[model samples]
Target: MRYERADLMTGMVQEGLQALVDGRHGDPFSILGRHQYGDLTVVRVLLPGALSVAVIESETGKVMAELEPIHEAGIFAGLVGSPVPYKLRIEWPDAIQETEDPYSYPPLLGELDLHLISQGTHYELGRTLGAIPMEIDGVDGVRFSVWAPNAQRVSVVGDFNAWDGRRNPMRLRAQAGIWELFIPRLTHGERYKFELLDAHGNLLPQRADPVARSSEASPSTASIIASSKPFRWNDADWLASQAKDRTREGAMSVYEVHLGSWVRIAEEGNRSLDWVELSQRLVPYVKKLGFTHIEMLPIMEHPFGGSWGYQPLGLFAPTGRHGTPEDFAYFIDRCHEEGIGVILDWVPAHFPTDVWGLARFDGTALYEHADPREGFHKDWNTLIYNLGRNEVKGFLIASALEWLEHFHVDALRVDAVASMLYRDYSRNEGEWIPNQYGGRENLESVEFFKHLNSIIHDRCPHAFTVAEESTAWPGVTNSVENGGLGFDFKWNMGWMHDTLHYVSDDPVYRKYEHGSMTFGMIYAYSERFMLPISHDEVVHGKGSLLGKMPGDAWQKLANLRAYYGFMWGHPGKKLLFMGCEIGQETEWNHDGSVVWDLLDRPEHAGIQFLIRDLNQIYAKEPALQFSDLHAEGFQWAVADDAENSVYGMLRTSEDRSSHMLVMSNMTPVPRYGYRVGVPDEGRWEVVLNTDASIYGGTNFGQMDAWAHRSPEHGKPFSVALDLPALSTVFLRWRG
Candidate 1:
């Protein structure tokens, strides 16, 4: 069994030493530790069986130094420079049997306490995932401790304490490395924040709790989270069920959603649905949509109202705008009950504002670099992570693991991956630092991404890790051993852009531009991908799918149906934005409702029906499912000129027992009878149609037809009928 991210790190390290001496094993010593970064990491011995026990850095392949064993039982320590990759070499006089446990450490119950006694000032929360308990007999007297090696002082302030900013000061504890104080009396339903002092006694900026249960901005007060549980989850059954069926890579068809705008709340005047209520209603609806998963936009706590959750404040806390921590847990539990997996849209890429949680987290460029140019994102105006820093990396990695272990999320779809990969991704020449070759790729970020993927996959094998990688990075979807960033799937922007460009053109213009529509297929075969009409295509200047069509109402609906049909038939997996199935006309508003009334219209209803049918077909048809990523599932045109305006392909399986043919016309003019190639020659059946009356299109061809055998096309049978204008049809070979 590949023990990825097993909780046995400390144990393995401790036991490894005794076995090495007892057997005089001619094997490399296994040395592992939670590296400089708090990421529980292991460096195995590959060449100990060889003479030299040398330690080399994995990134630059430079030798750090020779190592010697410390005179202790099952304990070895070596000095290594930098924290990229540590390699250990073990040597023995002769080969011997394995006797050392090679793995030992104290119980890995790593948690720390963080406390602040003031508000409107900066403070350092201990930079680790060590659990911090409180003595809250009456919801008050909670002690906090943060490991700010550079901070001079720290304090905690909140609604319970009246945002005084000066009354309470956390007494620093030396042995525990915690700053703590016990307040006499307090209760739940109160908000709070922290303040920190730098080396020069300069007050650091105050920030919210990274794991806050809830938050509320108080110009005259700080954010508060009630220390109460208002939610009761059906977790016992959920864990029992999910433990059997976990997440898989291809099994995912995510519906990227924003909770606040997904449904409207009652008291908020159609503003946003409370997390509790939204969970109650959304579970069944998403399951019915046939989406296997839902990747929610950042649910992490952030302060900005208009922000799309790219800017995050609380690292471990769900946004208070929804409800509480338990509330979010209930939401996840509910989704699992409905057979819908949940993946958080995590943003560890960059933090919001330079005055809050991440801004000067430990003082003196602790979590971020000291150089403003290197530390800040100019366009985003956010703080970049000091990924090389040990504590920061640990905090981030632990947070990632915590979500998977605690929340039972099926996966994580990392955002802003392009920015993380290249230091100058959005910068011009001379505007950013370069790699060793003077190129733009940030090797540190690359290593961090690799490490992150390894940790997640190691810890949660069934949990998938996806990247929103925009650049054409090589081997993005390849396995890590192939020298690639390990992402199971990538969003196919090429398909989205090209398909939109093709579908938006007039039918008269489409014939001349058939190749344009099929341009995305050229490179789509390079990687596993998800063709998405994501929120990015709907917001800002880019209009919604329905709004982009250049035609009348019926024509627009028809265009959407054809576009979706084409997308479904194309070579990649599929994802549709929240309101696209109903032909929502308006662009998505992060602060407004989805205009659900559009479903009342026949045109929109027809579009919804088409999507429902398409999803049904996608589920029922194995040819569509397994063949989606392979070349055998898709075939290009045999006739160059005729194929340009028309796309023809047969979806065949490994055994070839059953096959499906999808024929689409990009041209506006109707063809009297089109000859499509099929592998088999028998009776052929028209099983599906994009121009069906249910999809708001006039039924153009015979709903039921049987075609006799034909020798010309190399198929068991051939059909001759009116091919509808700008419509797709699927035919299967019959016995």
Candidate 2:
């Protein structure tokens, strides 16, 4: 009986050694770690280059037992009297290294964490997955975890293991699809990637941690172990004062910026400003410009700088190109301290096909769909997320929550929402798959948006979401309980298109396109809109907003100022791209800095000053902001005077006491006696005149005027004022 048992043990050791050498061990912990057999504890280890190995007491330096090589491949095993805390003393050809056995520790992930992850409700996946630094069983180490259900074996490989896949094969927590291993002495800043083998035993590419908090810079796609040191935020007051619902009935003028190109140091080889530099330069500038918020382009980690961060690889990591993850948090905190909200441009529509990214993760269609018709984004050559999968939805939703919770981001502007909502977006008839209901809409994406928005709103009451949806999707801003998309605001793309087209035409032909100026009012109150002249409008040969305007340099500047004035007074929150305020003459160059030198010219400075004043006035007066989302806030005093290229409208406060009259003259021909109707007979003072001499205009507007009791345009009062050519005027009534 003793001889038979010895033979069985020998056979078990040989089989384990072969499995380890082949890297086919699904549960490395079961065979390699210390295990009790009868009255003795069997210690086993697989150190590829080790000459010899010894088991020693973890507390004391006493040698417990020496392990004998059972196979030529450095498989060491020995029988100790008892199982206790111990470390492996490995001797290479010349040097010796002592480290705690990784397999001795139990599973690091709790059952609850696994359950939450499986159900797609793990809001704190960032802290649970990835390489998390923690002290487990009084041993300081990093717990590496990854989701690779289809992988036959997954191992954590890095400098610690000489980047060898066989050194640290993880223990698979079966049905949950998570593989985790706690490596002792692994601390913060250590770079690592998961080396995965496909189900067919074929080695796949090394993939970065999907939930990594920090990552190596582009070109080196390994994820780094980040310390979750508590950040000292000084924006409590800013957060406390924010309204639970921030989208409606408040002044929201967002200054959209691309961080890399906003300001670059030309003297330093034209390098982009770091996060600290941006906080110092950008925060004060946005505040001084009177913008309530600064909407940044995507700062998530991506391999290509030219994609402008829209194609992100690391969903949880801020791009290391600018600074570390903490640096980004500091930037947002600084913005909040200065009473400016920071809205991140989040891209959940598609992701690039970078090898180390989410594409074909685990050698299968894990994060994305397998079928190209349902999975591919043809326009960008990217992959669409498999939103139908609960785990994928949890991954995305957790990403959104991480920004708002960990980084204190005030809002998220979901990019390319139109693409996500439709299955046939940028696809022909046969190129797309219909949903179970056979509809053109992507039902999974719709469910994702609802789930994402509901959780974000419920958890972070002060944080809101804006949709960059170009379609006329109804109920975008309605509540989720009301069967809507549950976004706080939707980008007014139709308004932007119509208005830009109108301004691009020459003044002589402007009368023929007068409907463009009045067309937006038809759906102005549709879905709590945000009038966005975003970065998309200025790039890709579309030209800068200034370049898109008709006529020579002077008229172009004047038209831009007038257009801004009209936009500010329109019934929607405002979002002007960076450089539009200064009238960037050329198209936006993502590689270069904004044309800051243009401020040296009077015309450019005038445009900047006009935007600043517009923001200030829009914020100060309730009539311009109080009822911005309601049709009751606006009235067309003169909707049909297209022959003279004149448009007039009145903005009124909720209380009906304060009122502002806005008039625009699209032509270069000034109107002497432009009679605009007003609600009451009062002393009407010109609050802002875009064509004033101070703004490099012809100074064609009244400084002070009185509205007569005589009725005009079906109103009780009328004010006759000299309207400037290619300008807008704002008159506040003081009864």
Candidate 3:
């Protein structure tokens, strides 16, 4: 019976040691580190290049035992008296080194963190999942973690380990699918990537940390171990003001900028300015131009710069092209201190499919859908995020919060929202899948948006979200509790399309398309809108906003000036892409900086001055800012004047105590005596005239007009004035 008793078949230990040598061990912590082998304190370590190893007391630095080579791969093991605080003293051919053993410590990830991460509700992943620097058992090192559920094994590999996966295989918390390891003596600024074997034990390309806070610049894709030390903030006043502005009723004139080419150092290989330089130069420029906010094109780290950050991979990291993450934070703090709100263009709709990215993670369709119909974006050649996965949704939510809460960004302009809202977006009928209800609407994405928006509003009340949805999606800016997606604003793409088309036609032909200019008011109040002249309108051979005008150089400047006047005077807040303000004559080049030399020309400089004045007027007038979201704030004074190409819009305050009239004449023929209706009777002074010579126009419009109590164009008060050729005038009325 004693011989039949299976003597604890200890062959599994040999197999585990073999697996450790092969770097295929799934649980490194179980076999390595300080383990009690039935009263014998056994210590095992994998130091690939070490010729000799000694276990030493961590405090006194006394060598306790010499470890013999267990395998040719340089793994060493020895039985000490008992488990005590210790460090590894190793000798290489060229050098001898001493450091704390990585595997000597217990798991640092907590039970609550594991539970929240598994449930896909860990909003603070920036602190949880990435390579975090911490001290474990009085030993200083970095705790690296990643979530790759189907990986047979995962390792933290970097220069320190000679990029060898076998040196630092991690421990998997099976319930959460996260593999973690704490490597002693590792500190900030170390570059690392995760090497994983697929569930089939086939090696895959190393991947950058999905929650990395810092990344190497484009063309190089290593994740950097960043210092988690908090930035010293000086924007408490700005935050307090934002908290008081729950309604966000003030004017919002956003200057859309692409940091890469906004300005470049022509002498320094045409390199873009760093964050410090931008804070010194770009911030003052935008503020001087009277812009209230600056919306940067996605600053997220991406592999290709030409995509202009529209296709991004590192959502949690600001691109290293500009500067370090702290430098970016300083830039934001500077913007707030200068009273300029900062908005980051966020791309949660999709991620580029780089092998080292989140695509095919763990040899599975992890962050994206397995099926092409639901996962691929043919137009962009990118992979759509699988928001249907609760974990992925949580990941993106945590990414957004990283910006809103950690970076103190004022807003997020969610890009390509239309793509997320529809399953068949930019696809043929057979190339798409339907929801459970057999509908084209992406129901999972809808729920994700509602959930994300609700969480964001509940947590960060001082910040808001805007949607770049091209479609007429209902309730885009409505509250989630009212069955809406709960965005604060939506881009007015229809107005941009219709008005750009109207302004590009010859004056005689413009009369035929006059309805294009006035049709926006028909449904303007359906959703809160921001009329965006975005970077999309300026790039990819579309030409500059100025180049789109149909006329001679002088007339083109006048046309653009009139359009800006009309846009600023019209309903909704404003957003103008860079280079448009100075009337850039060429299509935007992502590789080059803005043509600041264009300002040397009188016509171009005129356009710049015109935009500055328009922004000032928009901000100074409460009727233009606060009365934007409701129909009661607007009324048509002249809508059916296609023959004369004249349209009049009367903007009134919510209390009706203040009013302004915007009369736009699309034709070049001067109307010596044109009459337009106004809301009040008295003097209606021309607050702004786009025709003034300072803005490169004929300068032939009346300075002011008298509004009599006579009915004209369905209003009680009528105003008579000489309307300039191709001009928009803002007539402020006071009784």
lDDT of 1 by residue, 1-735 (tens): 343332233324434444333322211222333233243333322222234455666455576655443423323344445555433444555642221111111122223322221210111222222113333322323444454556655556765435543434454444333444444344455566766667676766785655454566312224454454334555556555545543332334667788778777547576677667877777777777777778888777677857777787766667777666677778888887777778788887888664666677646776676776568888888878877665566667666765676667777778888888888867776778766898787787787777778777767655767788888988777778888887777888777877788788876676666776667777876888888788888998788888898677777777787778777777677778888878988899987877788778877888878877777777777677656677666665332444446776667654677777777766655666766655665666777777788777878863434566664355555666566766787776675
Q: lDDT tens string, model 3, 1-735?
A: 122111112213677878877879899888778876455577878888899999999888888889888777887877776677998999998999999888887777999999888777999999999899988777788999999999999999998888899999999988889999899899999999999999999999999999999999989999999898999999999988997787777788999999999999999899999999999999999999999999999999999999999989999999999999999999999999999999999998999899999999899999999999999999989998998887898899999999999999989999999999999999998999999999999999899889889988889888989999999778998899999999998999999999999998998897789889988988898998999999898877888898899888777888888899999988898999999999999878999989999999888888899999999998888778766777888888778888998888888887888888888888878887788777678898888999988888877888778889889877787878898988999988867
Q: Rate the local accuracy (lDDT) of all candidates.
A: 0.63, 0.89, 0.89
Residue pairs that clash (backbone atoms under 3 angstroms), model 2: none
Candidate 2 lDDT tens digits, 587-622: 999999899999998888888899999999999999
Off by over 4 Å in 1: 1-131, 134-141, 164-168, 171-189, 211-213, 217-251, 265-268, 637-644, 702-717
Provide backbone clash counts, one per model: 60, 0, 0
Error of 3 at 453 (Å): 0.8
Candidate 2 has a TM-score of 0.98
What are the models' TM-scores?
0.77, 0.98, 0.98
Segments in model 3 whose C-alpha atoms lie over 4 Å from true places = 1-12
